[model samples]
Every structure is written in structure tokens, then in C-alpha cells.
Target: MRGAKSAKWVVGAVIVALAATACGGDNKDDKPTGAGKAGGTFSLGLVEPVSIDPVNAQESEGILVTDNLFTGLYEPTADGKVIPALATSKTVSDDGKTWTFKIKPGTKFTNGEIVNAEAFIRGWTRLAAKASASDVATPNVGGIDGFEALQKGTATTFSGLTAPDENTLQVKLTTPDFEFDVKTTHTSMSPVPKVAGAGKNQAYNDAPIGNGPFKMSGKWEHNKSITLVRNDDYGLTKAHLDTVKISILNSANAAQLEYQGFQSGQFDWARMPTAQLTSAKAKYTAQNEWIQADTSGMNYLLPITENGPLKTAKARQAISYAIDRDAIIAGVFQGMQTKSTTILPPSFKDVYQKDLCVSCIKQDKDKAKSLAAEAGLKPGDELHIGFNTGGGHEEWVQAVVQQIKDVLGLNVKMDAKPFKELLAAQQAPGATGAYRFAWGADYPTPDNFLFPLLDSKSINKDASGKVQGDNRGRYNNPAFDALVEKARSTKDSAARNEVYKQAEKLAMDDQALIPLWNRTQFRLVNTKKFTGGAMDFHEDPNLAEISAK
Candidate 1:
């Protein structure tokens, strides 16, 4: 889930959520047993989350916490199929701009509050406020009517959202979106209790009362651990595990520590560090203790476009041409990742263009030199590459820096900080030259991948010019924005995908963001002791489905 990475819209964005299996096929063996012996505790090792608040969860760690703490109108299965959870059924208007969902009756939060239509309405309105502030709001409801007014703080509630009855929730969108139900699967679209208030309520965020399969056992312990117990009153698929304990360890070698903990039988689930992936496979594969799943997350470099040494397209293209992704994957990642040449992953088969990034597929020192010189870069100029520490990124980022030095002959430096600090720096205008970032899918659509990360409209700036939107790099292109809009409105999947492909090409040709590699999730699990614990499309474990064997 950490590839939901240092940030989510850096992980969570919305063209609209797409069905994972339809777009990209995952491991067929990924099916976990839904019926298993219950009543066992499952322990996992994890990195610290920035926030567990669904509205503010922008990174992978935070997203994991929210995933367990809440259930939305629709929820995705392990393979990414969107199914009704809080809602039993849905219908669309003739024009396709209006949608009404029938909320499942009698569902209640752990706190005994009813999970009615108002709960979802309040939750979405609160999410809009957070999105307005440039905080992490996913499944961007920007398509909904009155969203702009709500986001701009001009409205107190969403005019598009209305409760016709206690169990009926209706939404009016400015544009027709047939896949709106799929977008409801996001945690950001989950219902929240009244105590969550209308903004960042620290008390509620610390100990959220959820209507999901699990409930927080106590308050979050912050850098230490967070515990969850099964919510017996859950209305949908009930959790089989009695308790889920997530131990947060954020040391410099956190992933290594997690692997060690797994070996010592301290954790039922753990992530394999890149340094030990090969040895882990050798040791665990024979025992069926290792699981490798494909996720839609993409690791890349985000260059500050507004200002910096990477201000020009040629400079960004030069950086993309200089790095050797194969060496990093082979030497640092132990050949566990796939090199990427485009914004969309291969899973988006209908729209993905393999060779769209002409300069990224292979390293070209001559091309790098020419582009660097064209952008007025000299051999000795200092170019800083910033990244988050303690997330198994230091090694690969160092390799990238070395390649840039060797290829462009620049005085490259590494700027490493804590994940939170690095995120802040990346969002600030020109605070750093370039920083590492990754994005995982919320749903399967190309719009989900393209619009939020590249659209100029998605770029919201504060008075001080810091990015408050998902467009952290603050790239502005009227032509690119037009294509994204065209795709957003097109109802036919094939035609829409064509427009999306064009948009992706435009951004890539400009070298808007340097594509590195697609993520392959490596996990360690005690298969003999547990059943039904598997990675979802976002690389998060299906904690609700896990049970003792």
C-alpha cells in the first residue's frame, strides 16, 4: 500500500474508478477463501501513516488505515470489481447525469449511529471541503454538481446531494458519468459519523467510529501501533479475524525490520524489502509463504515545473533520458519490478501505449546531453533529487542520481527527508528540483490515472503558490486540459480511451513526469497459520477476509 506511496492523489485520483479485471488481469490464484475458521488475531508490520482520516489519507499507509476503518457505498473485491456494500442498488436518469443509490437498511456504525443517506452526504461534503484546502481527497467528486461551489467554500452543502428518504441518496453531476457507482468504492466516499464534523477533526481521526467490518480497538498510538477488532454489527461481509494489529515501525531500515519480524514469527504478514526479495523468494517460495501480486502503482519522478533547474520540458526530458531503469530494477529491486514507458499501466489495455515515451524506454546519453544543453544546463550545475527516507527508496534514488551524474555530468545531490517532510517540499513551489513519487489505482480507469495528475484544472494553488491539488508539479497546458475534458464526457469506453491515450501522449511528450517502473508487490505471509489474507488491487491486504487456519 505504501506505493499508494508517500502520497495518494500522489495515489488517489478520479477519472472514475475502473474494474481491475476488465482493464488488467492480476494473478488468477489471488483468490482467497471467503469461508474460513474465524476467531484469530492477525499481526502485520507497517510504516507510520500521515493520517487515518479518510478525507486526509493521501498516502498508502494512511489509505490502509482508512480502508479498514470505513466502508463506502460500493467496495472493491480483491481483484478490483466494484460491488455494493452500504448501497443495495442504483439507477441512473435518462440523461445519465443523475444517480440514486438505495442505502442498505439497518446498518449502524460501531458507535451506534445509523449509516443512512445523510451520513454519506455529510461525508462527501466534508471531503469536498478538504479537497478545497488541497488535502488528500480521492475519488474526486469534481464531476458532481455544486462541487465547485462547495470546494470554493461558497456553499455549506452539496446541492447535488439530497436524501429523498432515509435510505435513498441521490446525486446530480454536471457531466454524465455512467461509472459513478464505481467511484463510490473509494474510502473518501465512505460515510462518516457526525462527530467527524465538517473538517479535520483530530479527535475523530485519532479514534474513528466506523461502519466497516472492523472497529478501532482504541485510539491510534501514533508511530507505535493501531489495533482493530471485528465489528460484529457490520451489515455486509463480516470480518473473520478477531483482531487486526498493525505495528508501525519507521526506522531507516523499516522494510528490513519487517522481514526480520516475519522470520521470527512476530508478524503474520510483512513486506519483503527489495534488498532481501531474492533471498526471501528462495527461502519462502517452496513453503508457499510468499505472495507476489501485480498492482497498478507507478513509481516516478516529479519535476517542479513552475521553477527550478527542471523548469523547461527539455530539462525534464533530459532527466528521463539519463536514468537507466533496468539497472535500478535489477541491482536494487532484485528484478522485482517492470520498467515503465508511459503514464498508464499495461492493465489499462484499451488505452495503454507502450512506446509513447520515446526517450524513456532506453538510456540515451547523447540525447540527454543535447536536451540538457538546450535547457542551458552545464556539466557542473547542481541538480538535487529529493526523496522520502525509510520507505526502501534510498537505494534506487541514489542509483538514479548516479546515472544522471554519469550521463549528463551534472553535480547531482540527494535530498532525503521524512515522508511527511518530503511530501510538503514536493508540494511547495520550487522548494526542490525533483522528488520521488508513486501512484496506485483506486479504480481501473485511464481518467483516474490521467486527469488528477495532469489536468491544469486539477492544479489548485494557495495564496503563497503552494500546490493544494494532486497536480503537485503544477503543470499547465490548455491543450492537455481540453483532451482530459473530452475523455471525461465521452460515454463510449473505446472512444474515451482514445482521447485518454492522446492526453497521456501530450503529457509524456512534454516529459511532465518521468516514468520509472510499475510496482510488483512482494509479501510474506504464514500460509499454514492463516487463510484468506491477500492483496487487493491497491496492494492492501483483505484484512476482513483473513482467518486463522
Candidate 2:
């Protein structure tokens, strides 16, 4: 769900430009399978992942690696449907609080362990436990009964989870949710093999044994690369490619380097740096090898509300009103990015509302100056903006800093740190006033965009009051929270979406976060060397379907 954290965020590109592109695979044989020439390495570029272990892998880089290494009970399709993968059938109770899943029998992890109901139980239980240090556990599975107990370390397992037999998993939730199956598609919910051992095991993180179409060929070479070979014993749709090779590039010029690698034949699929996008598209588009897609990711600025100059909504709105998104998108991103008018991305067309945030309009220097004056902020007041380096954010951040200075007559400071360090700073007590934020939907639902990222319950505070979780800005509105809850408990889809729209409106009215632009995935592929390589609904490469040309 963490998008920009991907290595230069290369591996997270989606596809909307090429309608004729073969993404999933060609099932021309009229059979439920993916088959093709099967013996060659398919190489691509990647940034070093934070962690590949299912419990801790939340960023796009780590999640991309995990997707190839493990197939969950369900897989997200290009059409935004959660289709059965490891599980065959699911049934729900009338109250909608109880659900049962029938796992595919005899499915084996690469290490020869059975991926049964107990494996899913153990994996989810570990993810929910605070000792596991999983970032996804609470946001994705907090609806399960006793989740709070696990977070407090008072329970070792989820009280709502039960394995009726080797193949059956029964779950009880504290509240009704129709999209529980969709949430299971997340990497953290993937079944962990028994060999993984317990409690954030490092060995397993290095080389995980998985039950997918591919398995790790060897231990992950940190800051280097990772290679995966086809899982010969995999039970479902077989893979067309024999191996997947991912090169890890984390230098400040990673985007430039990745583009160069693609040109030199070092990569079959590569992300185009914004600087080279114009020329790359001009050349590759003619060859039908260019890809520009609308991603579910959104880039924003979180104005820390707990303390600092941005404590008031007026100050935050002033900041939002000052920046020129169209100018930045055209000047810096080479017209490759779209200016965002709302918190929701373009992919959520049905539920998305135009100009949902009144403060989200284009740059209005007069408005910004007036709002800042009302908030008692003026010239010479130091405004700090925090961001991470090596993620293609510096140029835009500088542009934003300059705009704020010219419009509001404020002295702005740019605090840049490494990605991981920036994340630590965001969670610490009295964090930065404003920081860069990027998120991809964990699932294709309005709740996926709202609840975990904005809801009050998503924020976790320790004894000393250090805040953690996705609500990094610490913005809380009971009215917004109430609307989100109403939406979640609603069984009807149309009614649920209506409530979500209201919640978004309330949050935006408070200027919860400064919406910059919806993310656009840019890539150049060597069609001569690869086929069936395309981005799926999750904005992930469909590795299993790709084959060497």
C-alpha cells in the first residue's frame, strides 16, 4: 500500500495506455491456465526493499517481491475483482460477521510444507501480534475479535480465527464487512510456512519459502538483487517464465540509472525517469513499447496537527492553496502527471467526486495570503517541510517550498532524510510540521482510501504519546469517523459509497492533508525481449504471465 517507497517506485507502474497489451496471459487453448515458452530469465529493475517477510513488507518494493513469492487465498484481478487463488470457495453467515474459507488441499510451500488453514491462521495471527512488528496487521485485520488483545500483547492468537479442519478456516468479526475476502489479497495476509519460525524471524525474511508460481532461487542479496525461479510443484496456473531477476538500485539517481539500463538491454522492463520521459515516450510510443497508466497511488503532504505552525486547518489550507500543481506536473514531470482535484485517485471513477476539497483548487496566491494572515502566520515564520531523498521528490518539494515563500512571505526549510529515517521521524513525538506522503490502495475500495489513512482509530499512541500508523498527521474528526463507520457497516454498495463520499467531504473541509497529484505509472519495455509483461490491478507486474521472447 506504500507506493513511493518502491525502488524509485519503478515496480509499481500500472497500465491504461495499451489496450491491446497482453497482461495476464493468453489462454488461447480455452483452458484455465497460462502456458508458453518456459525457460529463460525475465529481468527487471527494482529498488532495494525494506523487508520481504510477509509480516513486515508493506511498501511497493517489498510487496512486489512478495507477490511473486507467495500467492494468497485470493488474488486481485485486472478488473478489480478478488478471485479465488489458494482458496476454492467461501461462505458467509446471515449476520455477515462469520465467514468460512475452504483452502485448496495439498497446496505445498516450496519447502514442502502444506499451506493449509492452520498456516493462514498462524500467519495472520503473527501479523496481528505487536511482537511481529507488522505495519499492516491492525489496519487490515483490526475488525477481527481480540485484535486489540494481540496488539497489547495480551493474546498470542486471534480469538476469532479457528481451523475447523486442515482445509477449512472459519473467522468471526466484531463488525460486518462484505469486503473481507478482498482484504485477504494483501501480502501480509498470505500464508506463512511453518519453517518460517516465530516472531519476526530474520532468516525467513532473507529467503522465504512460499506457495506461489515462483520461489526464491536463493537468499535475497541485500542492496544487490533477488532472483526467483518457477515453483515446479505449484498447484494452480503454471508460470511461463523460468526465472525473475530484480536488480536493486538505490542511488540518488536511481531513476536515471534504471532508464539507462533499459536502453542498454540490462532490463526487460524499466521505469522511465521523469527527466527522460519526454524523449523516451517519443521514441518508445512509436514502437508501441511505451506505457503510461493511472495508478491507485496518491502523493500528498501531511500537515502534522499535533503541534507546530500547521496545527490549525487555515494554515494547512494556505499551504495547499499556495502550490501550483499544474505548473509542477507540466514543468517538472514533463506533463506525465495529472493534477489531483480530490483525495481519491482517477481509478475510483464511480465514487470519486470532483473538487471534493475546496482548498484543493489550483494555486491562488491571494487566497493563500489571506488564509495565512487569518491563522496569525506571516513573514519570517519558519515553516518546516520534511521529505525523503532518492524517491524523485526533491525537485517538486523545492518548487513547493519556493511557492510558499513567494505567496505567504514565509521562511520555509526543507528537511530531507533517507526514506526509513523520514518514516521514523513521522511517528516520533512532535514530528515535523509537514512531510511527504504517498499511498496506494491496499484493495480497490473507497474504504481502502479512507479508513486506514484518515480514520481516528487508525492512529496508535504509546504511553509517551508517540504516534504511529497511517494517520501520520494526527488529524481527528469524530464527524468524519462516524461517517466512515456508517459506510463500513452498510451492506448495500450504493449506500456504502454515499456515506464514504460524505466522510471524504468532511475530512477535506478540515484540510486533513494537502492533495498534490494522483500517481502516474511510466514505463518503457523492450518488446523484443519480453511478452505478457504488464501491470495488474494492484499496480504490480504480472510476473507469472511474462515469458522470454
Candidate 3:
């Protein structure tokens, strides 16, 4: 969940919740029944991989593939914890500016290259190279001492990084970031063998070598499928499944096709389409093969430009209070997902400050109309709403459009574009006044949610001079930014969380963006064939952890 990756808009941006709140140790109810029989090909239906190159991959589909293919220093747990992966343990200096990682002994990449500090150095060197231009790694990599030099082609290695031995790696950051370790969990830090390394090279993107439980068995078929075989030489307890077949059924009816495959035993698992949820539940009511997860992410509607009718904070607040989150959940998601009252999920319940948007979530149409009138908007006025296609957003977007019309009496005329074109449009100057959006955490920290999407410093001007960040909304508040900056600089966890609460409250007061329901995922799995696999928010049960029953 780290790196500067932002490609999640194609799928849904998965902003992981802050550590100790929404992370790790969340799956206590699922008991481990010893690894079942090995040697079975687990079939999964997924969209085509955007890029198999771990460093360049940013979307959920690519992450799903690489999570099993590559290993990083840390990995996310179901309960929202960042636990050690490649490293035995990580230690921080008293100053909190330096970190020391104790590497696991005898780990090796799929290509037989020894996994060591130099491996990481080489991997990062490639990513930092000017020619590589790794959009996903640029931001956090800049946190390192010599990263600027590396990016500018003046240095061959990070000055902050040192390896006294193969087993020891030390890094010095430009600033003190206690939650920095969680950033290492991203695939950007996954060590790649020099021979198999390629940032945008088609060869490497086609079949990248990995150090995880599985390795690419063959070339990635264009818009079709990819196969992964067990990595026998992996250091950890080996993967149970002998192979994994990831098929790309890109039909507009892909979900239904996959579900049909599951019904016909052609596929072992599939995600239930939202459109078919009601019927699917009825058809499979007695079957206990349902796998559901409350993924760590939130959805909100953004006002991409400030020059339109939604320019006023009151107009924005009206929209925020206007969304009937409960009705939206029931109408759009069939009640599979729950309404999100806070930007931060309940995973961080202690600090989420659910009371912040109590009135907004109350669905009081009168308050919304009053807020609208304050913005000089009247009943029957047209409100422009924009969104991107793909990722099954149509059905839900339509439902949301209808909700605004029925509740607020506003004419919600939506401009829908393909994901890429929509992003481009959103970034264009004088573009959208209202845009549907979502954000997933780059790291498991409140800073990921607050700073990137809110802090003015993160904002940048596009070609058309339109300001953008993940904030896309162009929502800015100096007070909120100050609170967020304080939260970032503070090392005390309690103080930081409290600061975040205040910051979140300030943002809620502005009501620049409307919070929608936090989406849930439901995948149908063959229970008898897979015994120990447990699904979670970010991704499904790890392929390594799944076994034939």
C-alpha cells in the first residue's frame, strides 16, 4: 500500500486505513485448519493485468498478481497491520530519521539471484534512473538522501542507504516519518534481479521474475491470462497450490460469465457482479461458499474545478449532505456495502470521529436544500456530475444520479468517459464541477488519507493550469492543512491521531466532498477445494496461503 502509485481509479482507489486502527489482526475469527492438500491449480477470473512489472503496477488487478509474485519488506494483515515480510524485523533510531532492517537469511529471487541489500540497491537504482521514470516510486523515493541525485542522473545509488553486510540494511530519511516502515510494504521496494529488471520494457512487463510464493510460469497472454507456478526455492514455507491460472474474461458480461463458470464448475471462484447479487444470493442461498471482505477504501464525489456552480463551500456542503448514503448503499450496492460516515473507516474506530458527519449522514433533505439555497442554487437547477466508465461503475453511478435527483431535486447531468479520458478531463482546466471519485491508501496511515488528498502542498497544476492532487476536488483549507502537517511531523501516535481527528473535523466542516458508502467485495470460492484460504480487504487470500482441501 505504499509508493506513489495512483492508478486505482481504473478499479477503485484502495486507500488502506491508518495502522493500529483499521489494520492487522482483524481476522481472528478464521481459525487455521492446517494447510490442506497441495498440488492443485487454483483458477481465478480477473481483468487483464495493466503491467506485471511490480514497480509500475498500481491498480488492484496488478497488485493481486504481484502480491503472490513479489515479496516486500512488509505485508498487510486482514486487521490492518503492517507485518514483516522479507525482513526478520525492522528497527528505528531514537531520532526516528534512520531505519535498520534485519534481513531474512537465505532468501533468493525466482531467477536464483541472492536476495540481499545490494539486490534492493539494484532494484531501486533501476527505479530511480531518469530513463525509468517510475511514477509510483518517485514521491517516497524522494524521501531518501541521494534520491534527488539519483533521479537527476548525478548519483548511482541512494546516499541514505548502506549495507554493512548482506544481512543488514540501513536507511536514513530526509525527515522523521514513523509510519515510513509501512511504505516498504509496497511492491516498489520488492527487490528485482538486475537481469530481469525493466521499468517499462515490454519483455520484463511480459514476464517479471519474483521472490514470493509463486513465479510466472510462462508469458502473459495479451488480454487473456497468465499462469503462476510454485516457487520451490522460496525461503518461507512453500505455497500449497501447485499452480494458479488467472484468466482475463473481458466481456462486458465478464462478472456474469465468471459466475456462470463457477456454477458450471469451469472456474473455482468468481466475484459476484453487483447486478446479479440479488439473484445470485437467491440461487446460492444454501451454499456457504461466499467470501466477502470490507476492503480498506472510501468513495466520495469531488468537485474537480472551482470555477463552476459547486464553487461555493455551501454548494459542496449541500451535495455532501444530499447523498443519502443509506439509500445509496441499498439502491446501488444491494446493501452489501455500508455507509461511510467518516473519511477514515471504522477500522480506525478509536480515532475516526464518526460524529463529524452525523448531520450529513442523517439524509435531512431540508438541511441540504437550505445549504443549496445558501450557495445560490435553487430547486430544479441543473448540477453537472461526471464519472469514468469501466470497473462496473455504471450501475452504481446511475443509482447515485437518481438519488440526487429524487432527494435534492437537482438535474444531475453526468458526463461519463473512459477511465483514462475521464482522468484527463478531470485534470483539464475549467473542467468538472462535480466528479465521482475514490481513494485508497498508499500506506496504512491517516497521513495517506489526509495529506495526499487534502494538503495544499500536494496540489499541482495540470497542463491546462487546473490544480490537481489526489484531491482532484481542489478543496483547500489552510487550517486543515496545518493540522495535517502537524500530524505528519509528530512522532507521538496518540497526539498524531488526535490531530488527525481535528483535521478531519475541519474538512467535514467544509464538506467539499460527499462521502459515499465504503464498497465491499464478494467473491465466490469453492469451499471444499480450498480449506484454509481467507479473504481480506486489499486482496483475496494469498495464493501461498490457499491449499487444495
Give me candidate 1's TM-score against the actual structure: 0.93
Best by TM-score: 2
Worst 10 residues of 3 by lDDT: 18-27
Best by lDDT: 2
Query: What tens-digit string does per-residue lDDT give for candidate 3 at 180-252?
Result: 7877776767788887554667788788888887899888997799999888777665677888998886655
Each model's lDDT: 0.77, 0.78, 0.68
lDDT of 1 by residue, 1-549 (tens): 225253222122221121221111112231222468668888887777877877766677877778877888876665555666777789988766999999877878888999999999988888887333636452367788988787777888899999999999999999887677877866778898888885657788789888877899989998899998887777666667889889988787778888889999899888866788888888888887777765667788988787879999999999999998888888998787889999887766778799788888999989999999999989999887888777788889889999999998899989888777877787776565788888877766777767668787667766687776677777888999888878767777788888888999999988898999976677777787887666655576668767788
lDDT of 2 by residue, 385-440 (tens): 98876667788899989988988889998998766677778878878579988888
- Greater-TM-score candidate between 2 and 3: 2
Model 1 stretches with alpha carbons more than 4 Å out = 1-34, 130-134
Runs in model 3 with CA error above 4 Å?
1-34, 125-130, 133-135, 138-142, 148-156, 196-198, 282-285, 305-309, 376-390, 406-411, 415-431, 440-443, 457-469, 476-478
Error of 3 at 527 (Å): 1.5
**What ordering of candidates by lDDT runs from best to worst?**
2, 1, 3
- What's the lDDT for residue 402 in model 2? 92
For model 2, the stretches where C-alpha displacement exceeds 4 angstroms are 5-35, 463-466
Which window of ten consecutive residues has the lowest lDDT sum in model 2?
19-28
